[model samples]
Target: MPANPTLYAYLRGEILPYDQAFLHVSDLSIQRGYGIFDFLKVENGQPLFMEHYLDRFYHSAQLMELAIPLERSALQEAVFHLIDKNNLPLSGIKMILTGGYSLDGYQPVEPNLMIVQQPVTMPTQEQLQKGFEIITHEYVRDIPAAKTINYSVGIKLLSQIKAAGADDVLYHQGCVVSEFPRANFFIVKQDDTVVTAAQDVLKGITRKNVLEIAGRTFKAEEGTITLQDIDQAKEAFLTSTTKRVMPVVKMDGYAIGDGTPGPVTLALLEELLKLEKHSAQR
Candidate 1:
């Protein structure tokens, strides 16, 4: 494995090394995976859609009935502090809030907020131009709307996904396609109709922006989608904070359309890249 560069973490009002921050083992998050987290990107010290990510984090914490120990303003300031402390030019930020220490298992107290930064590399130009393939598996996300720490199902399928000679996996329950392991899925048709799974998956910030940008050019519907529907579409793609609008050339053992990144997928990706660039400038 490659050596991950050391970065700073903001815990409460103190700044510490990423690996030194510690949490108790008796927290509900440790015993029952009762925690919420958010991922945001920092470009040239600017956090992209930071407020949106924080809003989602607040919502998720509320859903889990976990009270964040720090105020929103404080949290934002901490993130900026860490960014400056690390002297990071560009990086991905992950904020993890777990229910903090307790005397007994299954009990909760205040939440633990950890902000970490790491250098990242995006997919190659060839992978972006040609798109990537994925396999479909039978798995469902529990409380998929909340970005929780538990990822057992996704973890178990990692080997299967790799063995299929693909980039990732899309999960399906019966005929209804749920989502990818870490991204949302979308399908486009020859008639220019775009279909995607509704609120059952993560409300990805990037996914929302791409849909808003492409809504003028394509007809998008948010609803239940089937594996057969994916196979029938002219093109398919996955969206997330890290991958943005990633084209999906194949699903399961079947090729999407002609087994190539379709025109519509490429167009949306181009528009998304422009949006990303503009966002970074702000």
Candidate 2:
């Protein structure tokens, strides 16, 4: 067992105190917001879907032309090492690929990779049982396909979203819903068909797994979901690494269906919990 009282962070080739990890101001991630990251959940000190997360991480890096310094095996070793060092029971591991510090601040230097683990705080059971609310925005992200660290548009609209009595923002192009700020959005129709955006979304890990799980039992449609669809949805939900599967009660002042967690959403949530429960063993 590791005995460090402080948390450990991997920065490039060094593993040090989490607080001691630093990035230069000239780093493209800081100066130009050029970086990508992927998050995986840790349960019983075991990181779940690490390979899937890494595959997406590397894909995101490639899409951004960001070079990751360490190989996948080495990065996996580092993650487990960090987990052992911290000795946390349940947590989240976030892997970041930064465009390294440049002297001129405009050019991309060699990329830097960092791995850090933090305690996981899942959404409340009440929120899951009763469901949550969200507001919609008419905006699209730059490089929507890549999981870059640029969430300025999402973060900037936080206040407005909160003031509207909503938890997060669902982005859309015209009448079509794309995704939430940090989660993938989905809708279950009266006919029991699942619908979400296809082209302009992050294609989240949890989203992918949920599709696989739900597709086994329901019609999983990876296509456009319109605002009218939201209004007519029998149930709605969001998926993320930390959030898991959560029911969406309302969106943009419209009460989704009966404004409560529907049967399909609950069933999917149960399936998601099962997936999480066995992820460590796998």
- The most accurate candidate by lDDT is 2
Would you list the clashing residue pairs of candidate 1? none
lDDT of 1 by residue, 162-226 (tens): 89888898888888987887889988877988777885688888778877877879887788888
RMSD of each: 1.9, 2.6
The stretch of ten residues in a row with the least summed lDDT in candidate 1 is: 1-10
Once superposed on the true structure, which residue ranges of model 2 sit more than 4 Å away at CA?
1-5
lDDT of each model, Cα atoms only? 0.81, 0.88
Query: For residues 46-110, could you state the per-residue lDDT of candidate 2 as single tens digits?
Result: 78878789899999999999888988888888888898898888898999988898778878889
Model 2 has a clash total of 0
